[model samples]
Target: MKALLILLISAIITWTLALWKTTRVTSATELSSLGFGWPLQWIEQDQSRFQWASYPQDARLTFVKFDQLPAYVDWGLFAANVLIIACALLVIYFSFPLILRMFRK
Candidate 1:
């Protein structure tokens, strides 16, 4: 239950941040890179579309809007990423104590 709660909370927070940042962005050019551990920063480009991106560990840099595609695509990717990370964290959180106990013996 705790793990679920943690995951939900984490997802909500990350989604909120990403969504909020996304709103501030008007063009896809603002996103510089995609993948893990990239800090969100402003990068100017000629593109005028939207793309959904996910950054790890509160790092910035995610979301892009492209012409013709639905905004939901980006949001879906964002949600998936948030869930993946939350799940990973939940696993680590639960396992850490057990791992420590094993090593202590």
Candidate 2:
């Protein structure tokens, strides 16, 4: 039961953080910046034509036609985050007994 609760909590936290970070991405650059050290230039989009290049570029400029990022990328990041957080939590929970024993000595 405790392990299940831990997993549930980890999933919730991971999903919340993922949504929060994902919403902030307005451009390819912002998306690439999500999760520590995500690959630079992860998306390959065509550059604006020379005639239109002189205009000021905004977030939509990077997106071009896409309204949102690829679903697979978002899911992959979420899964990775959940795995990392759950592993960290399990390590701490399991080693807690050893830590307590050392302190009692």
Candidate 3:
């Protein structure tokens, strides 16, 4: 029972750390707004002459680009939330048995 409790605590900590790390990663790369109006207008006005000049070209690209969060980070956050919930459930399940036994005695 003690071991199970320890496992549950460890799992909870691991899950929490994973979620925190994921959140930090998201906060670091998230873009406030995408300056896309010019690009879109250019495309509509003249498809052949359309150029992505307004876009940040000089910024160093990351492996996980903030501008592309909807494509990647959103789903990652959803999955992490699910995993955190699952870990919480496991902690409850493992601890419940011991709790019940203590009450029975």
Top of the candidates by lDDT: 2
Indicate the residue-level lDDT of 94 in model 3: 89
Error in Å for residue 10 of model 1: 2.4
In candidate 3, what residue range of length 10 has the lowest lDDT sum? 37-46
Candidate RMSDs in Å, in order, are 9.8, 8.0, 15.5
lDDT of 3 at 50: 23
Across 1-105, the per-residue lDDT of candidate 3 in tens digits comes to 955665566545544443333111122122332111110110001111223435333222123344333222333444454455556667887899999999999
Task: Quote the positional error of residue 59 for candidate 3 in Å.
Answer: 36
Instruction: Look at candidate 2 and tell me the lDDT of residue 75.
Output: 53
Each prediction's TM-score versus the true structure: 0.41, 0.46, 0.32
Q: What's each prediction's clash count?
A: 10, 0, 0
Q: In candidate 1, which residue ranges exceed 4 Å CA deviation?
A: 1-4, 12-73
For candidate 1, lDDT tens digit of each residue in 1-105? 976787688667665555444224433544343222202322223223435463222323344455332222244555566676787677888899999999999
- lDDT winner between 1 and 2, please give it: 2
- CA displacement after TM-score superposition, residue 68 of candidate 1 (Å): 20
Residue pairs whose backbone atoms clash in candidate 2: none
lDDT of each: 0.48, 0.49, 0.38
